[model samples]
Target: MSKVRWKPGNLIYPLPAALVSCRSKTHGDNLITIAWTGTICTNPPMCYISIRPDRYSYDIINESKEFVINLTTTQMARGTDWCGVKSGRDYDKFKECGFTKGEAEVVDVPLVNESPLAIECKVVEIKELGSHHMFIANVVSATVDDKYLDDTGAFNLNQSDLICYSHREYRKLGQKIGHFGYAVKKLKKKPRRKKIN
Candidate 1:
């Protein structure tokens, strides 16, 4: 096999396409679709979202120091793409997207009711990195839709038909081959019965 080299850039594909909602005393409520977001830590439950300074929600989040990260689904593909392309400065995203504003428990910001899961975050720090500024936040609370829970009360997120962003396209999740620890898990062999003469 041969390898081709290219200039250094953000080549990572298949990232979670999140809808980040924010509200300010002056700007009201707004939603911004973000692909550059991910969990940063486990213990304290930290996450980060990078947004351009010119984005409408950037100033709202910066001033409020809070936002809700709503996980997107295949059903929300159009709205997700639309929100990213259009600015909240001119449009009321929640109303235009037909999404109800659900009240968050820990923060004053509203979440997208259509979302299966909403992660409420409070900004802890900000880092200016060229084109986009990063908002490092701590997860204050997370709300999951009860409809996705099984009889055993386990959250089946895969059943939600979640969508992801890859390259310049939005794609749905594929088949699940295995779960965590399945690679090293032992398989049990059935006992053979002795033949009777």
Candidate 2:
């Protein structure tokens, strides 16, 4: 195999397409579809979302310092793309997208009711990283839909029909290949059958 050289850029494929909701004193409620989002830390439960300064929700989140990261699904693919393209400056995203505003436990910002999971976050720091500014936030609370909970009380996120963004297209998640550490996990051995003598 041979490799081709190209311009330096972010070419990481297949990122979770998240719908981030926020509000401010002047802006009211708004939703912004973000592909550039991820978990940053585990202990304190932190995450980040990078947004361009010109985006309508950028000011809303920057001033409010709070938002909810709602995981998207295949059902929400069209709306997610719409929210990203349309600006809250003219359109009421929640109303336009028909997204229900679910009340967050700790933060005043609202989560998307249709979402299987919602993570409430408070901005801890902001870094001006060129074209997009990164908002580092601490996850204050999270709400999971009871429908996705298995009988064993484990969250079955795989069953939610979630979608992700790759290149320039949105695609539904495929089959579960394996879990973490499965490469080194020992498989259980079956018991030997008793001798029939």
Per-residue C-alpha lDDT of model 2 across residues 1-197, encoded as one tens digit per residue: 99999999898989999999998998899999999999999999999999999999999999999999999999888999999999999999899989999999999899999999999999999999999999999999999999999899999988999999999899999998999999999999999999998
Best TM-score among the predictions, by candidate number: 2
Query: Candidate 2 overall Cα lDDT vs. reference?
Result: 0.95
Badly placed stretches (over 4 Å) of model 1 are: 194-197
**Decoy 2 TM-score against native:** 0.98
Pick out the ten consecutive residues of candidate 1 with the lowest summed lDDT.
Answer: 94-103
TM-score to true structure, per model: 0.97, 0.98
**Where in model 2 is the C-alpha error above 4 Å?**
none
CA lDDT scores, all candidates in order: 0.95, 0.95
lDDT by residue (tens digit), candidate 1, 79-129? 999999999999999888888989899999998988999999999999999
Q: State the TM-score for model 1.
A: 0.97
RMSD of each: 1.0, 0.8
